[model samples]
Target: MREGWEYKKLGEVCCPKNKIQRAARCFDSSDKILYIDISSIDNTMQKVTDITSVTFGDAPSRAQQKIEYGDIVVSTVRPNLKNIAIIDRYEPNIVASSGFCVLRNTECIERNYLFHYVTSDIFTQHLMKITTGANYPAVRDQDVRDSIIPLPPKSTQLAIVSELDNIKE
Candidate 1:
């Protein structure tokens, strides 16, 4: 909706990368990294609970995205903005499902910016238009990778994130 912001698909700005859970192994109950599944992620921002575990043997081939503090992890299946979350210090090493679309941030776009942008009415409307499914209403990984967004100045993006943070506080 703002100037300089161009319409793009989720894939162009993001890689939609994924890691496969290994086979011929079982993860025990006490594993360290939190295993995130569709059920583990709520459609709305909520306390992350119901986490499972992935053993060293079962750990994903490689972490699809290094989910650092402030990064946003979006669920690809239902493809709802409310399900997005800003990674925090409290969030330890974790791996999400293949059904999850991990957005790698860029110099032109900050993580917080992507979070808000994806959740915005403008982007959501576009997302709704692109997504297809009668029951699942899914958006493909390729579609996500090609998605475009308004390219704002870095300082402006930081300021916006700050304002949003204040509101949350």
Candidate 2:
């Protein structure tokens, strides 16, 4: 840990709220909704690339995680594969599969920084160790919330993210 840096539980830095799960019958069949499943994300790109547009009646039972732009959705299953993506853009009626744990940044942490941290090897390795199930290993949402993260000043976080973005380009 560097000076001015502190280790904080992810739940403290990022608040994961809006756990609204509606039954498929709650929505109208004529209404179209943008559905994002764990598989629809291209983790390498760090963005949601593919999504399905379906009527609420056609939505899968797992399509109950509501998402907004800038939210970070990470697949709780198979954390080693690093299925994570930031919700950069979406239609007004966008919902994600329940397999994902959505993270919303707080004032203490930058959104991009939180996204980068969750997708890093450090985080994934930690998850790999605690995740159960040999064939379909997965961690609970509380596991992700309880994990600790190193948080620096917002300015420093932005600088680090900018440099990483440059390297990607």
Candidate 3:
């Protein structure tokens, strides 16, 4: 382990800042929302590119979580496939499927750092090992929260994320 680095459960660094579907339901039924599901994420690109525009009345049952600009959405289903993305685009009413484990970063952690960590091979391997179900092979939010992560100092975390971002670009 590097100096100034510490191991912590992923949950310690982030949380889900979500709004429930029931809140959306209580409002006007004719309003449209951007719904993100496993399919909405392009795993090959590691980006969300397939958001569905659906009216509240017709939204799927799985569209239960409301997400924000920087939240990281990890597909709880089929962990081996590695469906994950950080939300970059913003819309007022963006709801994600229950199949996603949405992680919003806390102040101590950099958003991109957490995003890169969960999408990394280390985290995928962790999820694959803990997932249940035969056909679906899903992981629970608890499993993701309990996964361990190595955190360097805050400055190091930002520097690492910047380099990774540059490589991606």
Candidate 4:
């Protein structure tokens, strides 16, 4: 770790306090919700491009994770493919598949910084090593939360994010 930087478990920096895992049936059947499945996101683009609008009753059992804007959603299945995206938009009815582990930033870390870190080779390699299953290698949400990250100062995080954004453009 660099000077002034500290190692922090991802769980320490982010995750909802209550750790609420709402069920899909919690919503009314007639209500329309924006559903994001693993396929709805373009991991390479780091963007969600194909959200579906479905009644709550029509939602798949996997469509149970509520998401807010800025949350990082990483696929728990087939992690080698690195399916992940940062939620840039939020609607009252937005929800994601349970196959994802939604990571919401807290005061200790910057959202973009965490997003970039999880999408990095270091993180992916670590995930690949710990993941189980041969045909469908996967990691539990706890595996993601337990991953350690080098947390730099907020200013440095912002600078890194800016440079990364520029590279993407």
Candidate 5:
């Protein structure tokens, strides 16, 4: 833990939004939007590197929670499992599984820093505490909204991200 880096809940930095719930439309080969499910992410890295098969008409007509480049996507349903990913590309559309939480740092918070923190042991522990249910665990929208996070200056966040990247390399 570093100075000025406080613990904030996942909700403090992001809002929860799901793709419009409607009947799954018939799949068409020509559909434009790319469908990325939890399976698309690599188990260890939780990052999406390859998308082999694409299905059409599966996307919501009104995609309210589109994922943009640099945004962090977290799986809320099983926070203890620490399933998460950071979007580094500028995609026209990105939707996640119903249990996932999309976090958009409001420029004040560093997306990369938040991305790493969400997968840390400490954060995962916190999520486990907040999550409800035993057999079928679940975290609600309000639960994420009230989550606390450390608010650091941009420079510090950049440094943390750079350091983490180097360590990864």
Candidate 6:
């Protein structure tokens, strides 16, 4: 660990998850959204490779998580597959499947830094430990919230994210 770095639970550095309607409460036929599902993420590339356009009338039951730009979405199901990505360019109609645990950064932490932390092998292994079900191993959203994150100062975080993003490119 760095001399000035600290550790915080992910939930501590992230905004509280807003409570949204869990089910198909109501939707007009004309209402539509760009939905990112587990399949939408190319885990190998750590990017959203496919976004399905769906109208509210035919929206998947799991398309309930509204994400904003800079938010991180980690797949709760099949944590080993590492389906995670940051919402780099969100629009009003962007929503992700509830299978993803959406993470919105608090002021203290940089969003890109948080994204990099979760993409680590350590993070995936931690989730694997809490994963349940033999046929469908998965972690709950709460499990993801409880994970630990290493926090450097904002400047250090930016440097780390920048280096990693350059490598990614």
Q: For residues 106-135, could you state the per-residue lDDT of candidate 6 as single tens digits?
A: 899988888889999999999999999999
lDDT of 2: 0.84
Between candidates 1 and 3, the TM-score winner? 3
Q: Provide the RMSD of all predictions against the true structure, rounded to 1 decimal.
A: 4.8, 2.0, 2.0, 1.5, 4.5, 2.2
Better of 1 and 5 by TM-score: 5
Top model number, lDDT: 4
Per-residue CA lDDT of candidate 1, range 105-138, in tens? 7556777778887777676666678889889887
TM accuracy, model 6: 0.90
55-160 per-residue lDDT for model 5 (tens digits): 4454544222446676676776777766678877676545455555677776567777888877788777877888898887877756655667776767988998
Between the candidate structures 4 and 5, which one is better when assessed by TM-score? 4
Tens-place lDDT digits, model 4, residues 125-158: 9999999999889999989989999999999999
**Model 5: residues >4 Å from true position, as ranges?**
1-12, 15-31, 49-56, 59-64
Better of 1 and 4 by lDDT: 4
**Each prediction's TM-score against the native?**
0.69, 0.91, 0.91, 0.93, 0.74, 0.90
lDDT of 2 by residue, 43-90 (tens): 787678899999877889888876778888989999998989988884
For model 3, the superposed segments whose C-alpha errors exceed 4 Å read 16-27
Model 4, stretches more than 4 Å misplaced?
A: 20-26
Give the poorly placed runs of model 6, Cα more than 4 Å off: 19-29
Q: Please give the ranking of all candidate structures by lDDT, highest first, separated by commas.
A: 4, 6, 2, 3, 5, 1
lDDT tens digits, residue span 73-166, model 3: 8898998888999989878788888888888888878888998898899889888889899987998887888889899999999999989989
- Estimate every model's Cα lDDT from 0 to 1: 0.62, 0.84, 0.84, 0.87, 0.64, 0.86
List pairs with backbone clashes in candidate 3.
Answer: none
lDDT of 1 at 167: 85
